[model samples]
Target: MAGPDLTLDQARQQANLAFTASGTEFAFGDAAALPLPIAQMKALSAGSPGVETLHDGGLTAEVLCLKHAGRRWAVKRARPVCRVRNIEGQTSFLNELQRHAELAGLRLPGVIRPVYGSLRDGLVVSPWISGRHPGVLDERQARTLLETGCALIEHGFFEWDYSAGNLLDDGERIWLYDFGYCYRFDPLTQFNSAGHGCEHPRHHLAERIEGRHLFGALLDAGNDDEALPHFIRFKRLAAQAYVDLADRLARRGATPPVLGHYRGLAARWHQELAHAPGLLYLASAWQAHSSDLDDDLRGRSCTPRTLQRAQWLQATLGAQGHRLRRSGALSPDDAALDDTALLRRYHDREVEARRCQL
Candidate 1:
């Protein structure tokens, strides 16, 4: 395996980016988006932030439901220490502050509007909308997700995390809240902030959804079978989103090569959607399964999906491993395992991963 994308010294510097306690005032981005003044927000966060409506996972910070004036808001106070422990986790809060600072005043439908944020005070306050975390992503939700995701990429921000916990639908629109994992990248040239950029262009917006949100839902046999239709729906939406995205990028004066790069994946997916939906499904499944499993193995944050992916790989190898292998779907490690050894390996890993799950 190659070394980490960053040098050891760079990693150390990144890992040290913890939140500091200072009296630095929360910079209010949109006072109009807030129900209360900056003083009220400061007071609410001066101590343990109140929990009017609780949130599940912050990983990098403590999230609370803030009650101010006659409204509720989300106050994400940076924990003195982050739960994620990695360089991304260590710097996530600071990264969020930076992203929010850029997106503060933008009137984007899919992005959460921040009322206030700060580096020293270690928190951000945004209006609390009564929203639902989607289960089976409906057509509107799927379309909105790709639309917004493309928008972020076009604007030079690469949002890395798209897990269910980070998204909310207020019935009218979908909103992206967490920016701790979102980083700045060249929209016109880079594939993502992960160093793939245009060099490895396959990792686009739809792939992010599959890894972070969709595939986890397809945890078992029944859901896995159902995933085909869900994926098709997303692909359809994404095709249209790409069309709009390419036009917008061109208008923004993106270079022709960059514009061509943006349009290439979309055009291919569109053609496949028209002529060979099944091929697209197989390709997508292979990519999603391979990518997500590697993510778990690397992070070692295995959930049921880790087990499911392993099982799926074993099944695919038995049935059509040759075909998948020819198509570059099977990883070198996966290709090396015999049936008995693979099952045995997955079972052991599954047992270990289960302990980490709940």
Candidate 2:
């Protein structure tokens, strides 16, 4: 195996690159290799013929698709100003530039690497992946995404946002192209890149997929009968993936707590999948939806799906607050609220979510 593209030391040094008044130039390999010259790439505009503008609800950059040398390429330009008001939003472009280099080096499958990028020029170029954002996930698509995500975790890259826009399916395989929100963490010791790394165990790989994408797809299901089968399939896959992840991390000398974490989850999921899968689904659904809603609210980038998620929470709280509480799905504060109080709280959140639409 060639191993990953950059060593930890090299990745750290690259991350510290500073932008001067003249702007820092960055590239994965040969910037001269692009079909278009750097000057022409920097001057690309949406109005130009043969350019197809893509507004994928991205907050930090504008994406344009065009043909070059008989092939399609996606040219992403950083927005003059990012839409989200947070610090992470402000610096995401530079962060992505850094990730682009590291991921290019790793050369992981299904992860599209940029041919060239320049932070100073606020540009990145990659072959345009030929796929659409799946409105719903079949078993094959779900397993493909899960396998790809697991591979990333094993390599210490934690991808936070697996939203619909960040994914594509070119008939045969799913592709992950964006790296703006992907960050490095110690796979042997930490659960994720969130607060103090291991402090947030709820932000694991399955939670992210379930919260950001799967549950959203389930929201359109007519009833539990329709959604239950899909959730079951995913949970089965996740349990096995956790088992494999735990084994790999253990061989790498992961700490006891980290190993125990994955093993415990696998055990519990297996137990639940055999006996009380409904409770498992309910608990995971509550956590995933609530967490994702909070993320959007904090980032001030809520969308129509955000509103729907808020509504789902409110409705679920009304109909199954008791079940959620019994299933240990509710947090301490949420567990304390009565049904009416919980309903009212989520209703307020729904209104706020609508106000924050990007």
Candidate 3:
């Protein structure tokens, strides 16, 4: 939606005007009962500034905690120069402001409520949610996240990022906040916003949860004796979530291809659960965790979990090369290699990955 004539700053200013004209709720100047205008939130204090500043908040903006008058709010300020540099990255802050305009009134329990936002001011405000990222997800959390993802899908919003940094669990429920990567898509007749959501059936709600959050934690868990049981538990929950998602989407008049996508996913997991469940888990965990790790490294956003996953992959390739090969997680060339060769290959990659470790 940005243009060459319009600088990023100009584009942002335009976005703010567009949203304001549409009557989105905005709090400022002692009207909405805030301690400060959204723009001034970044300077809440000298060094504190009340910024949450999540490491995984992506490269476009700085997320800060804002405490005003007796209440706390999250005031995300767009960096003067976005770190991402790509068109999507360059325009993400504006995108989030626009998305907030659409979501400001939707009282979805799983979705975070947007209080106010302004691209001109380079900030958006929302209530601050507090909770730990329960490294391991239980059924309740998994169900909540997947169901909310499905709701977003049904409503034509396709969210691309589901990283741990974008979510919070308040013990009772999992809350999704960031909308920087969220885009529009057709839910009934087409795939996600990319093409038709059906073309890449692999990018499901459950898949996002596993790749973004669950698999990384399993690395922290260590060893198959422990990780396998944890995965099996989640797989069972995922299977059910898929069933419920498919049913809900079906009633919403989702197209056959779309419905088939969800149902097929459920059937595969259910079928595998009845038979080759562990094999399924091993292959999935390896692919999900490994791919997610590669993503972090590519983004130069390595976390403690990223380093742990690299170590785990190296050890697993060394200890169970045959099983990993059979799981089809490694590349075909690597899989065809002997145990010693495969282990060495992974070890070298692990070493490179560690170089960027934080």
Best-matching candidate per TM-score: 2
For each candidate in the order shown, give its overall lDDT on alpha carbons.
Answer: 0.71, 0.82, 0.71
The TM-score measured for candidate 3 stands at 0.82
Candidate 3 accuracy as lDDT: 0.71
lDDT of 1 at 107: 63
- Which runs of model 2 end up more than 4 angstroms from their true locations? 1-23
TM-score of each: 0.82, 0.91, 0.82
Q: If the candidates were sorted by their TM-score against the true structure, best first, what order would they fall in? A: 2, 1, 3
Tens-place lDDT per residue, model 3, 44-72, is 43356454354334577776666656677
Q: List the residue pairs that clash in candidate 3.
A: 50-65, 51-64, 51-65, 52-65, 191-196, 191-197, 191-198, 192-197
Q: How many pairs of residues collide in each model?
A: 1, 2, 8
lDDT of 2 by residue, 21-41 (tens): 336566565678787788888
Candidate 1 global TM-score: 0.82
